[model samples]
Target: MAENIREHLRRLLSVPPGKGKPVFLFWLYFFLVITSYYLIKPVRDGLFLEHLGSGMLPWFYLLNTGLGLLVVCLYNQVRRRIRAVPFIQTIGCALILVFFGFRFLFGTFPALAASLFHSWASVYNLVVVLMFWSFADDFFSLDEGKRFFGFIGTGGVLGGVVGGWLAGLLAEILGSANLLIVSSGVLFLGLVVVQILGMAVPSRRGKGLADDQEGEQLGSGFGFASLYRSPYLRLIAVVVTLTMLCTTLLNLQFNRGVELAGFNGDELTSFFGSFYAWMNASALGLQVLVVGPVNRRFGPLPGLAVLPLICFGVFADGLFAASFSVLVLGYGAALSVLYSLNQSSRELLFIPLGIEEKYRAKAFIDVVFFRLGDSLAALAQLLLVSTALFGAAVLQVLGILVSLGWLITLRVLQRQTS
Candidate 1:
């Protein structure tokens, strides 16, 4: 009966025949990387709110934007020399060192230390996940991606649940600062998973480069040139930008709500952590039980449309009240739907592109353009907050408008890709 149940789940999840091992390895990698990152995410949010206040986050977002551009440029250069796995390992090592440095400095100057960690964590979370997608694109065929990507993504969602719950449980005892060491440990374990993948997957060697990747040179000029040249890429950039705008606005509002709810230190950390756990748990269930079957039956369009549709319905009802429970449910629904359905669809959209476009141009879209959108959204939010008149309500309206644009972009993108 147990074996039969296992087979049933395998079929339901659309696991490809004879590809179980590779899929599991990919799942493990995704799980480890996201677990490491999510462990820090809530802690980072709590620290920033405690030390910098909710209003100052726009400055950090702007700082992250500039730093993200620099990192993208440097990453493009570094990828020219090193393969994907080694590059990931190097990043993990550097983050481990940085966490230690933060730990030492946190004793004397908490705010400055937390600020630096916040910026770095933002970059770390996006870049690592994007790199994994890039690696997967190089290794898997388009057909395989459509079938397996959703299932693989569930691992990350599950990881988020675990990491968030663990952080919540540990926050009181370990404190938010010590969570840095825990994050570093998980990241190192992720690197070890990468090494295992290096040995287990034969075609995964040499940075998971595709056959067409042979002639592509590394002097890609931040990938903006290709992005400007391709209409498809431009549309994707716009979608990313608008999505970031909506998310940033929602996040700012959520943070303010949390602050107003008046939780501090360990209480704040645990609250955010449990909130993250619930969101990701919902995302995990959707990815496992809904997204894969939905994609198989209807295609990526429905999956792509889910988030914007949810946003339009919820945010359009009334003003965004800055309260703990309301923010929890609102942001939770938005994030869960976005991460489960929208993210899986977005990653699969890259499958048909060339290797250079997939890795380099996609990097620009994922890292630089995404952060640029965050920066712009943060600036907008900053201006609204400064005016001190109906800031949260206006932001909710902006989110609704952005969601409408997102739906239109999805329609166009589907037509073009189809």
Candidate 2:
């Protein structure tokens, strides 16, 4: 009976024989990476609110954009020199050290630490996730990606559920600052998983050009030149930008609501932790029940369309309702789709590109462009709020407009890819 159940699970995920070990390793690797980030996410936000307040979030967003560009540039340089596995391992080690360093600094300079940690957390999550998918793109063939990426992505969703729950429980017991140590340990475990994964999938490396050849292919353009050169990439950039714009607007509104509700310190941390836990729990359901079947049946284009349509409805409703519950439902639903269907679909789009473009261009789009959209949204928020020129209803309208733009761009991209 147990063996029969295993066979049924394999058939459901469409896992090819002899591919189980590598797929499971990749899944575990993603699980560890996301788990570590979720642990830090709530702590990062709560500490930022406690020390810096929500008003400063926009400046930090701008700071994150700059830092994200620098990191991607550095990442491109390093990636050109090393194999994918070593590059990921090196990043994992560096992140572990950074977390430990922050843990120490929090003792003496917490406000400053909180300020810096916010930007670090933002950049850190983006970089690690980009690296994982870039590596995955290298590892899996296009046909295999269509078959397996959704299942692989389910690992991250499950990780988010577990990590968020642990975060809520741990924040109460360990206090928010000490949660950094716990995250550091989780990252260290992630590094170990990376090592094991590297060994288990040794043959998958070097599918791209050799180190020197890849560097030359990447050229002096770094990543921007690729974006300039490719219409498909440009469309993706626009989609990402509009998506992040809507996301940032929704997040700011949610944070405002949370702030006004009068929670502080660990209570605030616990609240965010629970929020993420529930949100990711919803995401897990979508990943299991929605993403795979939708992608397999209609292909990724339809899956890609889901988030914008949902956002459009949610924001359109928000314009009428304009309540905390509306913000909660809207943001939660947006994120649930974003993390599940949207993520799997977006990563599938990269499978057709060349290795140089996969690593360099993708890093730019995911990190730099992702943060560019975020910063622009943050700047817009700051201006509107500071000037009192627009109301929350106006922001809702903007979100609705952005969602429509996202849908239109996705339509164009779908046509191009088709």
On lDDT, the leading prediction is 2
What tens-digit string does per-residue lDDT give for candidate 2 at 263-381? 87888888888889999999888877888788889887888888888778777877886677777877898899888888878877887888778767886687667777888788887
Model 2, position 376, has a per-residue lDDT of: 79
Best candidate, TM-score-wise?
2
> Once superposed on the true structure, which residue ranges of model 1 sit more than 4 Å away at CA?
1-23, 83-86, 130-149, 199-233, 296-298, 317-323, 347-364, 387-392, 408-418
Model 1 lDDT tens row, 135-176: 776568878887888678778888899889988988888988
Estimate TM-scores for all models: 0.82, 0.84
Clashes of each: 0, 0
Cα lDDT listed for each candidate:
0.79, 0.82
RMSD of each: 4.0, 3.6
